[model samples]
Target chain A: MTTSTFSERGAAAVGSAAAAAVGDGARHLIEKRAAAVDAYPAMDAMRDRVREIRLHTLAHLDAYLADFADSVEAAGGHVFFAADADEANAYILGVAGEAGAELVVKSKSMVTEEIELNGALEAGGLTIVETDLGEFIVQLSGDRPSHIVAPVLHWTKEQVGHLFADQLGVPYADEPTELNQIARTHLRRIFLRADMGISGVNFAAASTGTIAIVTNEGNGRLTTTAPRVHVAVMGMERVVPTVEDLGVMLEVLGRSATGQSLTTYTNLITGPRRPDDDDGPDEFHVVIVDNGRTAVLGDEVSEVLACIRCGACLNICPVYRTVGGHAYGDVYPGPVGSVLSPILFGFEGREELPYACTLCGACLEVCPARIDLPSLLVNLRERVAQEGTAFSWLDRPLDAYEFAATHPTMWTASIDGASLAGRANRGGWFKRLPWRGKTWTSVRNLPAPAVTSFRRWWKKHHGA
Target chain B: MAAHTVSVLDATEGPIVVPSGSCAAMMIDHYADLLSDDDALAAAARRVAGRVREFTQFVVDDLGLDGLEADATGPITFHPSCHGLRHLGLRGYGERVLDHVGVERRPLEAAEECCGFGGLFAVEMPEISGALMETKIGHVEATGAETLVGYDMSCLMHLAGGMRRRGTDVEVRHIAEIIAGEDEA
Candidate 1:
């Protein structure tokens, strides 16, 4: 299909599947964040603090990760560093096997999605239940996440009603509060009966050897606490040097992410449940997954790792606003998604994603982590086009333009030819033209060039 | 090396000629940059800067282009791009130029919003960038203007691609030829 038809159909699909997924997702996120805009003077102030914390932590990543692993091991817990997604999945499945974990309760975690961990575990004969409300909805519907922060953003309340009725054998309800209550009651059983809890860490403190999980729904708290063995998976980059840095980052993260002064619950897990702690997991396993991120860090575009998964860029993005996130056809959507997806998945399947923008600076303005989004997008496009990673057709025009740009004589000739042709067709404008120019004029009128080119005018007037 | 010197000419009453609106505004805001202590550099800067007036402002105020007999028939929407509005502060210059050419100026909604075609940005963040252009195209469609005229070619180029992709029927033109009454030529 043509880009227009594809986008039009894709937009309609996204619009219909969920009660205006983008709008509802935006409304939910905005309502939450608007409360904090007044609470935080400027997004920049919080952003700068977050940047410092992330930078400081990244600098000491190795040392902190080692310390965190040491702590988990000392407290009779297990720690594994998976070089890639497959390795991470294999390691998690092995742990499930050792513990004989049949039913696994999971909190919202992007790392698991990255590693495809749940599928691996399920393949290993474990029934994994996602406890987070948004994640549970997506899991039930067997749909991929539309938004990073709000996974089931593409699903409307009515869709949720259908999915719940079909999957959980529950009565259909359209009210958000009612659906949420139904999900809560159903998930509460999994939380109580699960043999293992799998969760993603927001930040890991190197100094105290602690894992931090920030959530609004409190499902993360339950998932981590209810099971006998809690398995925490995190990206290698998700570490902080000290507790102070964690405190600073948390302040910025919650405020910038959901616009909450603080997430309803911020759980810090240190080496499993303590000996005296009544209701906490006894065995803790911290899995550090480094799938392509280490390679990303080595590149100039490593700054993308600084993303906190706030989805602020997505929320404010005009492109994401109009066509929604699915058009990009990636796990992550919107501005940050465009840059990171190509790097993570390579450009072969996603060549169309880069060509879909006007480069407005809104995404850059709203990013709380202050990622140089526009520059990264440009860098990726150049990589895709010039490097011949994908979309080989783009090279022709680019090369032609490059050649014309370099050879001034040819450039001037082309301009003059264009001007002459334009003048000839100038009843008012050229409705169509030959070659690629026709591609442009096919949809809109091309202004016929002046009878004289600018260069010619300069020569005539200034006697160059 | 020759030492630079400055010469102040008596203000001329005729049209103040300028090459571009951005440079013209710079002359007004940073005129001090032109008047260096060195006389020759000062004269050269002033001479160059003096030619940087808004096409319409220059024509209406300096050249009397508006008084000339011109065919003003077509209804065109005026989009004062950021550089022209923010950098040059040539507010309403495009409108005045269009009016002079005898074209009816159709006002566009959210006309001031960036078209997301920042030179390198179009290729960079295509998704978000395209999203912004969608908003811009929506505004242009709302105007129902036959032709979308703006001062910047870069913005038009990006918008033209987007309009094509969306299969919209609106024409983009530079303000220069429109005001010069050169569209027919």
Candidate 2:
């Protein structure tokens, strides 16, 4: 197929999948999510539980992660701690090389995405297939995930219908069930013929060394069981102290994510095919990726690690609703993405991401784990400014303003000058403004500053 | 001193009187929190949950600003900053307020989103932050709105800097200031 044809088909497939995933009320998905979540009586209970679990886990992350590694090793699985994406990808590719793997079937793993694993594996001449329905659509489209939980949320149904017909050799159909069935059929064959299974861990239990994978479809289970070797890629933050904490997290994950009581499938795989087991993989490996998360730990923004990938912030975000995830232009999106993307990718390409929020605090309000999203976004923005990344033109004036505000003499003189100008422009607002202030008046009216500045009014009233 | 007895009006449909914009935003956000209690709070919360309109919404809906005034003859554009657009869901509320005040509402390109002030976000991510604000200023300049009105003061302040740096003729005012007819010199 031509490159353009492929892109068109991919775009169409993703659009249809998103429509299916989002269901109806596409115009007002955020409002609908608010209403649906508002009506759910169990949401509050789940949020409380999830908050407690995350707090406890983050407090003892080091101990739990070490124990998890120990348990996995004891269960006949090897654990690798990769400090960054390059190291993680190199290690995974090295493993694939050792195994002499050619064809790999994978489940949805954001950690792998973070490391850009497919590119590395593909470079090694390995044919990789993404089995998860959403991941499959993204792979076919060659698009990055717009959401944490729902990857293809940007597309409409008609788009997906067109994609499936062109790429999968199926007739155009937008109905969710038909499209899902089509994907399932295509990926089933890939799973049965795969040499290795790669998946992301939702929660790693330290007590039992079990990796939990939650999904609505049964793709995750198949990806693990059908392949001879199962490789689980996880961020270091994915571990919980025990299965009890995992249970609480799972409860919150389902409710806060999609308002479901439970995901259709929740698989806990402890190791490869056991000696007496009827069906499972023969070899198991766990890759723990630090990827800037260690730097985030012990910081004021460490509270971000508590995220369970629920995508609650995406559903409720006003900005995301309008521009969608691509506007942020990162692997993550919405309120959480605004804070995390800059920290991970550095503030170069994603400088606009932090400023995209209204600081309305909606993300913090709905976060099941109670992450202080607005504060973190603010903190990250401050860091970016302090690093002198802000445009010089704006920065100089802001610095000058800050300096003047801190100095009583300069501040008073400036206020007096502004007040005089306000009086001169009184009875009619200034059609033109001075300096960068013109940017504001250029679009809307500058209320000609107050004829009497607020400071002046306060001084008169309070005898300052 | 006049005792301003602003009635803490309870929306029989949403929630009770919520004073602050952030607090009202919070109410719509944590609607579940408002409903987790007894029937009284639940009913009250539901009534005010989605019903907590912004100051602009109240002005346009209750005061009927459009009916009171004819056409406002001036170059007027609006900035729908984060609080008004994202938190308060007041996309066109400012226009409705301005239209009622008899002001000429000029169409501004990319006027519906944030100006990147974001309270502390401007200080935090200053470069990207200023870049966003500059984008907003460019759109504002393109509109040639002699007056730029929004619901939040913080955004106006940030935009004020961009305007001053570029030496544009745009002015910034709060929606409340305009609606209360306090914009008159």
Model 1 agreement with the true structure over A370-411: per-residue lDDT tens digits: 787866876777666666755464467777876876666788
For model 1 the local lDDT of residue A189 reads: 78
What does candidate 2 score on TM?
0.69
Best by lDDT: 1
Off by over 4 Å in 1: A1-20, A27-35, A74-76, A347-356, A430-443, A456-464, B1-134, B140-151, B157-185
What is each model's TM-score for chain A? 0.88, 0.84
Best by TM-score: 1
Q: In model 2, where do residues sit more than 4 Å from their true spots?
A: A1-42, A94-100, A345-353, A403-416, A419-435, A441-443, A452-464, B1-185
Write candidate 1's Cα lDDT for B1-185 as tens digits: 11121122213333345444433454544453535666656565566455556565666667666456444356778777665665565677777767766777888986766776654445434444555677789899888888888877777867876786677888777676665565421
